[model samples]
Target: MKKGTLYLIAILWAVIVILPFLWALRISLIPTYTTFVSFFPKSLSELSLVNYEYLLFKTKFPRWMINSVLVSGGATFLNVLACSMLGYVLARKRLPGSNVIFTLVLALLMVPYHILVIALYLGLSKVKLTNTLFGVILPLSANPFGVFLMRQYITMIPREYEEAALVDGCSRIGALFKIVLPQALPAVGILTVTMFMETWNNFILPLVMLTKDSMKTVTVGIADLAFQTLNTNWGVLMAGSLLGAVPTVLVFVLFNRYFLRGLTLHGGLK
Candidate 1:
C-alpha cells in the first residue's frame, strides 16, 4: 500500500473508533432542551453544565456507580480467583473424570447463558438468595470462559516451578500463591478487565437479581432513566451512557497493555 493510502486508512480507522465517542461528548456538552434541536449546537453559546449537574443532583447515579464498582470489582475478584484455581487443577492435576469434566466444560461454553438463566433464577429464588448481591456473584463466580482462559494459560506454565516449590517445602496452596499466581498476574489482569467490563454493563443479571434502587448498578440505572420519558432527552441519555461506559474504557486504557501481553503469554510454562 502507498504511504498516503496507509495514512488514509489510519484516519478512517480512527474516525470509525472515535466518532461515536465524539458525538457523545458533543451531546454531553450541549444544553438539555436545545441539545436535541441540532446536531451541532445552534451557536457556541448554547452549551451548559446542565447534563452533569442533573446527573449528579437528580439521579441516583452516584449510588448506582458505587454499586457498579462494588459489584464489578467483587465479581471480578471472585470469578478470577475461582477460575484460576479450577483452571490450575484441571490443567495440572489428573483426576478420575478429568477428561469427561474437560469435555463438559467446553460443551457448556457452547450453551447460551440466557437459556440457563431461568433455571438458575428459579434455584436462587427457591433458596431465597434472589434479588441480592450474592445472587449476582454466586452464579458468575464459575465463569466458563474464565475457566478456559485460565486452563489454557496454566497449561503453558511449567511443572518445574511447582516441583521446585515442593522441594522448598511449600504446600500446593503455598506454591500456587507464591509461584504460580505471580506468573499468572498478566492473565489475572486480563480476566479482571473482562469480568469488570461484563459486570459493569450487565443489565439482565442485575435486573433479575437486584430489585432495590440502592442495589442497582449503573447500566440498569441508566436504562431506567432512558426507559419511558414522554419526551426522550437524547442529550441526557447520551451523557449518562457515556458516563456508564467510562470506567470500562478507563480500565482498558490503563491495563490494555496487560490485556494485549496476556494474549501472547499463553503456553509459556508447560
Candidate 2:
C-alpha cells in the first residue's frame, strides 16, 4: 500500500476507536433531556457539569469507584506475583510434569471463562464470599495469558545472569527477586496493565458476586444507573462511563512503553 493510503487508513481507524468516547464526552456535558435533541450543541451555554456533579455526589458512584480500584489493584498485584512464579518455574525448572502443566495452561487459554461462571458463583457462595470485594478479586487474580507472556519473556532473558548470582552465593529465590524479576520488568508492566484493565472493566463477575450496592464495581454501578429507573439518564450514564474509563487510560499511559517493549521483545523471540 502507498504511504498516503496507509496514513488514511490509520486516521480512519483512530477515529473509529475514538468516536464513542468523544460522543460520550459530548453527551456527558449536556442535560439528560437534551441528549437526543441534537448531536451538536446549539450554544456553549448548554454545556455544564451538572451530570458529573450528580454522578459524584447524589449517587454511590464514589463507593463504586473505590470498589473498582480495590478489586483491580488487588487482582493485578496477585496476577503479577502468581504469574511470575509460575512462569519462572515452567520456563527454568525441569520439575516433573512441568510440560503437562504448561500444556494445561495453554489449553486454558482456549477455554472461555464465561462458561465457568456458574461454578464460580456456587463455590464462592459456599465459602460465604458473595457480595465481597475479595470474591470479585479472587476469580480475576490469575490469567493464562499472563503466565504465557511471562514465560515467553523470561525464556528470552540470559540464564548466565542467574548462574553468576548463584555462584556469588545468592539463593534461587534471591536470584529470582534480584536478577530475574528486574530484567522481566517489561513483561510485568504488560501483565499489570492488562490485568488491571480486565479486572476494572469486568461486569459479569462483579455483577454476580456482589449483590450489595456498596460492593459493586464502577462498571456494574454505571449499568445499574442506566436501568435503575423508568427513564434512563443518558447524561449521567455517559458521565459515569467517561469517568470509569479514566483509570484504565491512565494505567495504559503509565505502562505503554514497557508494554510496547515487551511485545517487541516477545515477538522477536518468537
Per-model TM-score, in order, reads 0.88, 0.89
* Candidate 1 C-alpha lDDT tens digits along 119-147: 88889999998667778878877777788
Q: Give the TM-score of candidate 1.
A: 0.88
**lDDT of candidate 2 over 1-270, digit per residue (tens):** 899999999999999998888888898998666525676779999899999999999999999999999999999999998999999989999999999999998877777788889999999999999999999899888788888988988999999999999999999889988999999987888788778877898989999999898989999998898896787888899899889889988877888776566556444433
Report lDDT (Cα) of residue 248, candidate 2: 82
Model 2 residue runs over 4 Å out of place are: 1-13, 35-38, 258-270
Off by over 4 Å in 1: 35-45, 260-270
Error of 2 at 177 (Å): 0.9
Local distance difference test, each candidate = 0.80, 0.88
Model 2: which ten-residue window has the lowest total lDDT? 261-270
